[model samples]
Target: MAIQLVTDQLSNVLDDTLRSQLVGNFKEIEKALNDLDGAQARLNSDQDKINQDLKNIKDGNEIRDVNVQAIVNILTKYDVPIQIVNGKVVDTTKEGE
Candidate 1:
């Protein structure tokens, strides 16, 4: 089946050359529009994947935070000799202090 276009219905009498050129221009525009539409679809799919990845990371972070807090609470409750030094948790238990 052929793509029916409005220019195809035009009477190609004395203005056949001009009408043919117009048809070529219209075909080029249609091709560009199709390419643009395809790019938009691909970008939308990529964005959806990125959003899902971000959501997974956020969920993992929440779980990690809960676990860290639970450990901190237990250590604090037991009065453990743990201290943060230079952003690291260190055990301060010594033979005599």
Candidate 2:
């Protein structure tokens, strides 16, 4: 017996079309999932860098103001609105008033 053959051949034809459509839909979903995974990996990498920098600061290790400035500049390049005040970076959008 054929994978699609049934008592009603017309319905089986429709079933084949539906199956193809479902396969196409799944392929698209798979691609989207892969893209999301890539984005999440990139985000994790960035978070790791931020964590290391923060750890350095928390350890009381000497860090130049210019090094902080460079980090601010990197964030700014991504169009992330942040303000540096007293050597701390604050999200400008979250500020009250």
Candidate 3:
């Protein structure tokens, strides 16, 4: 069996001082719910900002990909073989060829 506080049992408690304390408990519960609602609103706002920032990051990545493709296209137009060694771009074109 579970212990539960039914409304009829609460009404049977005839002490005026004890009844006043119960009213205060309801007020505290209401305040807590209000605080939770406010926090949820702030979380929702932050989530929207985070979503927009993620979209911006995705857009930046696409722009970077397009730029890299353009550079590749331009580089392919030339016949000079290029090499990257030790974090440096080196022209590997032979003088005789």
Expressed as tens digits, the lDDT of each residue in 1-97 for candidate 1 is 2445555555667597767867876997798789889999999999999999999999999898677667766896899877555645677788678
lDDT computed for candidate 3:
0.71
> Among these predicted structures, which one has the highest lDDT?
1
**Candidate ordering by TM-score (highest first):** 1, 3, 2
By TM-score, the best candidate is: 1
What Cα-based lDDT does every candidate model obtain?
A: 0.78, 0.75, 0.71
Which residue segments of model 3 deviate by more than 4 Å? 1-12, 80-97
> What tens-digit string does per-residue lDDT give for candidate 2 at 1-97?
1133222323345577667666766777777779889999999999999999999896654556667788889989998899698768888886574
* Count: clashes, candidate 1: 0
Q: Output the lDDT of residue 24, model 2.
A: 63
> How many residue pairs clash per model?
0, 0, 0
Model 3 residue 57 lDDT score? 100
